[model samples]
Target: NSFGSCSRGCTTIDKLHWWGASIGNAGCEELSTQLVSASKPYDGKPARMVKNLLLGGNMVGDACMGALARAAAKGALKDVGALGLSRNSIGDAGVKALAEALAADVLHPGDLYISGNRFGSTGALALASALSESAAMRRLERLSLADNRIGDEGAVTLADCFATGGARQLESLHLHNNNIGDEGVVAIAQVLSRTAMASMTTTADTKKSEKGIFRTTFETIGTLERLFLCTEGAAEKPQEDLPPAELLPPLYCLRTLNVGSNRASTRAKGALAGMAAQRSVECSV
Candidate 1:
């Protein structure tokens, strides 16, 4: 059958939830080629494939999406700088495959944006842990995980991973609309400070700054450029409150902050503001 005819048939059978029929109509070879082609859009070209890969809202279910992601990784789809796989019907299998794909050496030094999928707190945590263990993830510059049901547990798992040495390469992180409350955020802040300190100190810099502002410090996470915490009319409610400085050090790298749609009080905002003031870290509430 022609590509269009095969694709239409596959869609029809998939709508019936008869994955077997869909796979039959598409044929293994054709499906494999299509998936590989979609994954590696520019395989032979000199331009790298590190730009962006957005496969959200496709409703891919069962093993189909997982297989496709694996194929992409095996094909050596290099330079996939940004990947967005949101709103798909991803289950444990899909999650595992996607995690493996992201952790693969073929995709590195890029941004990963995942949200609106069927990944719950457990799945999100699993994926985050896998990414943390991957050498590829260490090269990431940005990560987005919004609008998912990743509760405090998932948030903490991700926080712990990001706090580790592997996450030092990250410059931007997005966790808006997740179930991360004050405790989770606080954990993340603590890690950010540690990473920033590691990035700042050198053998030559033995003297402390008079203003306490170490220019050599990378400020591992001072501020983000864009943060979307509000969901329309629900901007005023403060969800959680951070602890005192005695509990954790300040994160001097933050620039922009967004804390909307939660129970975040004015006091919490003030505390965040106080920390940001020194380094000009923008605060949003």
Candidate 2:
């Protein structure tokens, strides 16, 4: 009853905040139908204007997210800039479904929150692959994957995505409590340090008079601003075959990094701190 009312009223609305409503599979299915309906041209009225959809804590699972993913692929929710699915029962299947839409360029979210779900390396890898493959993913600004179990393998893949120039506009990345280890953190740090060097080269190439025009010249110079990696565990063994730091490219956009509560060795932590200091990035480890 209420859902029907919402569907009818949503035609004019631009955001839906229904978190913690316990709207499970059935409710999500119904909502997805409305989304598809609203996507089509309707009597010359502007199609559904929903720009933000908050459905966290609703007990939604993979099946429901799959329905939403299908709707997204069909051009529904095209205007969504922020999507919140935190604290749900989503797993790899659900994440993979959404990744398909992302890869197909049907879903472009500036901010995506999927923390506290039930996905691990497979889901993380899927998302990383999508980010690498989808040019549309460059619109992503903030991503929250904290409190899940994307371990070191997942972290390395995501780092590789950055290395490959994916998610170029991403600013904030939250990966706290994800069971990341020293190898993962080191890989990410390596990317950041390399990026910083590149930024330095650009800075050196600039004319003295144009230095003051920082924002206008280098607004998009950095790839990330804030990174969270708290509560990670130590690696059982170190990663080998790491490329020499000088051989890597530069990364200059990071500002804040949280690597506390982890078991990374003192040497690794010191190296991270030194790198952060070199880049003038705030380090909390």
Candidate 3:
């Protein structure tokens, strides 16, 4: 079987050709087993090495991803840097399992491809929350979440993550055809604007920038949240104003953001206009 042949590479072979010759969950099960056996003794002997696992083009669902997460937690697939799940049926449940691992710091993918899946806002929020809470940060350089339905709400959540600099190491983010609108576009534009401002300014306070264009409209809201968290008397005290860019999340390392093919809303077009005018990053929308 193609799966069997590919498994051999983890032990004692050098080949990249593998075609699943079975139907149903046979391929997934076989590959899952082999991946768990990676760098571990096989048949009383050591096999080759498999550092990355590619399981795209398979109809792997949530259950299978859960199994993979278990294996990853057990240190069976410790060296895997990439998780290719493109063109699959993974939805909210599946991504939730993956988010669990990411949240627990059990898996740190260099590249995560979940495009063409059935994930929605729930899944997006789950992943965003996990990443926001991720320890040691993600090694993710490229992330493909395009072609899903993460709507405006999900888009805002993700934008908040970027604004907070949670995924500063990320390089490319693909969200095309994700049913985004002006609200989402505007939120993302704010991120770009903040990033641009951060680049031009020398201080940590985006509002202190001599640019004179710096404003704290967004940051003002965050301040209110923090105030609400303060003790009774402390909550009533006014806090120093800061620009949203100053409170920007960890996204100093991002390079490209693709949000093309989505329905643009009138409200977001203005923000998009400024972003488009600057053309600072290699963004496509």
Candidate 4:
């Protein structure tokens, strides 16, 4: 349909909190369709001050939801701080599209919560890479990617992306209930170490410009405060048969490591103990 029709539908539900259960699915689909159409003629102007976009229960089929979400995010909605798409509502393709759209802009950074959706390694990596590449998303202080089927490969890709300069503004990262094991954790740790070093070096270079140094220091502190690594309910459980504790020393920088509800055996505990002994890695099982 035309932008006018889509705009009207968006406006209808713009202020209304509840759009009724019966029409929720249809409404979302209509909105998605309209958004896709509108994005083509987008003028790069701010559209709205959308603080939150919640598409949890709306069973909108996955065709171009990503593009549509991106289109809605253009100008007016650029300042959107929160985007929630959880549960089994949207398919992998839809989720991927949404992430791709969100990553396109460096201005729409905030909290992104996507959980309970059965995304495979490819989808997980796509979403993670998108977020990592978005300068705006890097400014975010929190990101949650829980309950997805992201394996070690996906985790490695995400860790690499975050390590890139694109994610310099990150403060927190949550990847719980995925299959990211010791290798994934190691990748994340390496990134954190690199970022910390880079931040320190940047601060040291500010001796020449006092004014710039002050601003940089403030921004750097803000970024670090938000950097949290929380991995609760991950796939691998700590085993009873402990490996040499020497392997655990590398993950000391992690703020909150959650491995609850997993089948951590004795071996797992030993490995964790070894890590704790080498470096202070707080963990919950």
Best by TM-score: 2
**Higher-TM-score candidate of 1 and 3:** 3
Better of 2 and 4 by lDDT: 2
Model 1 lDDT tens row, 60-82: 55465456565566663454455
lDDT of 4 by residue, 104-172 (tens): 772354556566667767887777777656645544545667777676677778777755543433334
Candidate 2 per-residue lDDT, tens place, 1-285, comes to 111234311333667878688989889989988988987879988777577787888999899989988888778877787788999999999999988888888887877889989999899999999988886676676688887888888888888988876775555677778887888788878877776666454221233333343221332232232121111111111212111222334333345566655556677667777887877867766
After superposing candidate 4 on the true structure, give the runs of residues whose Cα lies further than 4 Å from its correct spot.
1-25, 33-48, 73-76, 192-203, 207-285
Ranking by TM-score: 2, 3, 4, 1
TM-score of 3: 0.72
lDDT agreement with native, every candidate: 0.48, 0.70, 0.65, 0.49
Candidate 4 lDDT score at position 42:
50
Model 2 spans with C-alpha error above 4 angstroms? 1-12, 203-252, 256-263, 282-284
Predict model 4's lDDT versus the native. 0.49
Alpha carbon lDDT at 217, candidate 4: 23
Worst 10 residues of 1 by lDDT: 225-234
Candidate closer to the true structure by lDDT (higher is better), 2 or 3:
2
Please give each candidate's TM-score: 0.59, 0.77, 0.72, 0.61
